[model samples]
Target: MTQSPLHILEHTFGYREFRGPQAAIIDALVTGKDALVLMPTGGGKSLCYQIPALARPGVGVVVSPLIALMQDQVDALRALGVRAGFLNSSLSPEAVRDTERALWAGELDLLYVAPERLIQDRTLELLHQCDIALFAIDEAHCVAQWGHDFRADYLRLNVLHQAFPQVPRIALTATADVRTRQEIIERLALEQAEQFIAGFDRPNIQYRITQKNNPRRQLLQFLREEHSANAGIVYCLSRRKVEDTAAWLCEQGFNALPYHAGLSPQLRQHNQSRFLRDEGIVMVATIAFGMGIDKPDVRFVAHLDLPKSIEAYYQETGRAGRDGEPATALLLYGLEDVVKLRQMLGQSEGSEEHKRQEQQRLNAMLGLCEITSCRRQTLLRYFGDNLAEPCGNCDACLHPAETWDATEAVQMALSCVYRTGQRFGANHVIDVLRGSEAEKVLQFNHHKVSTYGIGKNLSAGEWRSVFRQLMARGYLDVDPEGYGSLRLNPSCRALLRGETAVHLRKDAKLAAPEAPRRSPARDIDPVDLPLWNALRACRKRLAETQGVPPYVIFHDATLREMVARRPVTEAQLLEVTGVGDSKLARFGEEFLAVLRAEDYEGAI
Candidate 1:
């Protein structure tokens, strides 16, 4: 008799139950049906396919885009006593031959390959000779040409369905919007597959977006106040910024590293390895990083510039707090970021239609940043999910923004731009409005205009906010050809005529100074601290010996459970989550000794 999926789940993976449609999706795959799974990060999407792969007769072939992470994944599976191996560019020819022999001998349960390798004729022939369980395509969003993470190799993945129509295929991604979802379905030829759309919300993450005022200082404040001893990722818009930020953070005594395309491959790999293996290291990077990073305990993800679209922002921020522990997603944006982003988009070479579509996406992202309502709800709604109520965890919910009518201010700003010939950028128009007697203002003769000095009531920052909101709301437009000069859009006509009343959120004067909120995951009792630290030290030592990430040894959650339960015997240890049979037989006695020693000490 074959072991049931539930039996495998308990004895192999050691989880008590499946989470959020995992069981249904697993059942569908185990029974030889195609599936398109849309699950969030840390949502156990891997389990949906892994368990089915085990239950089925043949090895599961996983197509992954991340070459760097393949070894990590295979190492983790090997630790679980699963016969998993990867074939990629990183392997030697002898190692590849050995893996092929294992596959032919049916000695492997799962195999991971890159899309480029999987599409090779020889590789396809080898797969044809095996009794394949299924094909799992991770990061399916890369198939969409317009997606931020597009990979040309992914476009050829449709051949999987064409070549092996009988074998089940599952396409999984955590960051697909509605259009991208449709594109995935059409491109992958999974039109008939069962679609499992999980909720997009990551309730464990607390979202915060602040106007970028002294952005470096704001980032420092966040790190010191909230994530002093935690692992995090800081995303910048440029490679130079990433290098500079990483260097500055290191000077400030942070375990910081930079990752980008421009870095030498050796340096990039070394930095990524250090970040994965060590604790409390912060990786400052451009969008080039964090596609397939499996680190589960990242405490925060901060953005130093505006992302290109809501999908891009969501995907980047979703990297935080994957362990279901409380985490922070901080974004700092200023008028300059908007102007730079707009300029970039304008200069990008694409069809007019494509450019228009990208601009619309940018506008949507700007709306999300400027929205005064619930950030989470607004974010989910963009992905076609509607929350019944506002999430109480985001900054907007914690500190509701206060709005004030900006009718007269909007009129004055628009009139100033118009009267100044609409060829000047926001800085010049702002200077003219604020009655600046600067040389440029006099050279442009804007001080003599009737609109000059009409807006002295607002500060430079306040006027900048008004202009940003106006652009975000479509009341103003940027003339890319005119060097980012401000122009009045048709929407401004209504505001100019007093036919519409515009209200804007009062930008917070400064980021509030507050300690990081305590999280349940980190709420170990005073007495348990010593034991927790000891357990962590033991895990770290073992991880070093094994050359695998500590989380691969055991997650922090599992460690916390061991501390809380203080299991004395093998049976009790087995009762703890994540302590599978292989781990029990391997390191059970070592952990039991730690617990027993701690218990004895407490008695003393």
Candidate 2:
């Protein structure tokens, strides 16, 4: 019997199978045809190109926009004894020269390059000189106008095919709308590409939201009980919030790190690297943290703040369960998150119409967070796919949701917004519902309003449910400019007049008594012990030396990996997943310095 290339793909890439439409995409690419591969996160997206690359006759040029640098990727490949190299601005003249020499000598299998470098005059000339295989544009959605990480560099991708018209090109993205699919094809010059759209369902990831009450405590409880210190990323809306949340996690004895744009470039890079190592380090960061990151073992992605849109939420959450392991997307939200998200969008630099579209996307995210029916069904429906039941893996499934008939509650909440002229935020509305006689409440004369105290039947918590559910269901809109004041959208007219019946799912129930805390995070042994200050020092040193995302280098995974393996040498050190070439060469010495100081070596 003769061995097929797919058999070799399974052994070399550590995969035994091709998933979803992967076989078709690989077939097309191998036949010298262009392709568009759209698989969800954790789906075998890389195999679509990797398998074809190895099967093809020449070096595969994978143009990627991952947050890591050339050193990180090239090293990972080299560690596996696969001949791979990356060319980018971050590489030194000597490294770049060596890589080019290897490429020309046919010593490289895959050559990873930033899109900018791939389109350079010298680079294109070099490509012309070398025998090129397929060109894979990873993170293909960045070329799409609707994508979160839209980049002008991606727009230049068409030049690759234009310059080498015969080269097979494959564009891969985890998330894309129909419009984005078209944009990617047009932008990447893959006009004749075969398109493979995989299911967007992440059945293994549980989705849940905790009402924001003592949010700090709720977050702590969540991490402690359900999502502990596993390879998780905690999203914050601001740099300050990122810092504070990271600090809070530290206090709770979680191996947590903070990442934001405000950090030095080197610091961000190091933090990113750490997170990717994947032992388990909680990374608290803003929206800048994830874009084309390749780490596959993230256990959970939690949001302390509302994400800007459903696309962002989906992409971020998709970061979890990349290893085909079960994960969760837990959002700890309140009515306030909606307002803040709206405010940020409203004040964004884009045009009015852009803001409008952004609002629609945000509304979609809000709807998903608030939905009670099958979480899987709603998400797929949005992407023009549908599922029939709640994915058993989600919070909605573990704790079956109860419904609250809000017919009269909706009218009261809407009347409050309407009488308040829809100018006030949730705080003011809450005050009116509870009939608070506080100074601000009286100053606005909200106490005298007809709708005031009408919601007294509901507790402050219950009233919040009314409004938040209304906003999620499209009966109301949040004013983005004012940090989320309630506004009457067109859908509200019928609802406010009692012409429509409104219902919302009761919030997810707490874990049952005697049940172990819901998350694998409790398996951590820090016992909430103090490792934060130590972790920060380790994070700082790693970031300063390696010029990539600290999260990428030592993400939650690396930190936990460090704690578990305690690698003591260059030999043992390379075992960490995210420890790349630049990072190993740069910080490898200092990490040894720590191990020697603590007399720590691999034991866990």
For model 1 the local lDDT of residue 269 reads 85
Cα lDDT, model 2, residue 543: 53
Pick the TM-score winner: 1
Model 1 scores worst on lDDT over the 10 consecutive residues at 512-521
- Pairs of residues at least 3 apart in sequence or in different chains that clash in candidate 1: none
| Alpha-carbon TM-score of each model against the true structure | 0.97, 0.82
Worst 10 residues of 2 by lDDT: 595-604
Question: Mind sharing the TM-score for model 2?
Answer: 0.82
Off by over 4 Å in 1: 510-521, 598-604
lDDT of 1 at 518: 38
How well is each residue in 1-604 modelled by candidate 1, as lDDT tens digits? Answer: 4578998889888899999999999999999999999999999999989999999999999999998889899988888889999999988999999999999999999999999999999999999999999999999999999889999999999999999999999999999888899999999999899999999999999989989889988998888877888899999999999999999999988899999999888898899999999999999999999998999999999999999999999899999988899889999998887887888888889889889889989999999999989999999999988899999888888888999999999999999999999999999999999999999999978889999999999999999999988888877878878898988898789889999998998998445533374333368988788788778877887899999999998999999999889899999999999999988887788788888883534422
* Candidate maximizing lDDT: 1
Can you write out model 2's per-residue Cα lDDT over 90-143, one digit (the tens) per residue? 788998899999998888889999888888898989889888879999988888
At residue 376, give the lDDT of candidate 1. 98
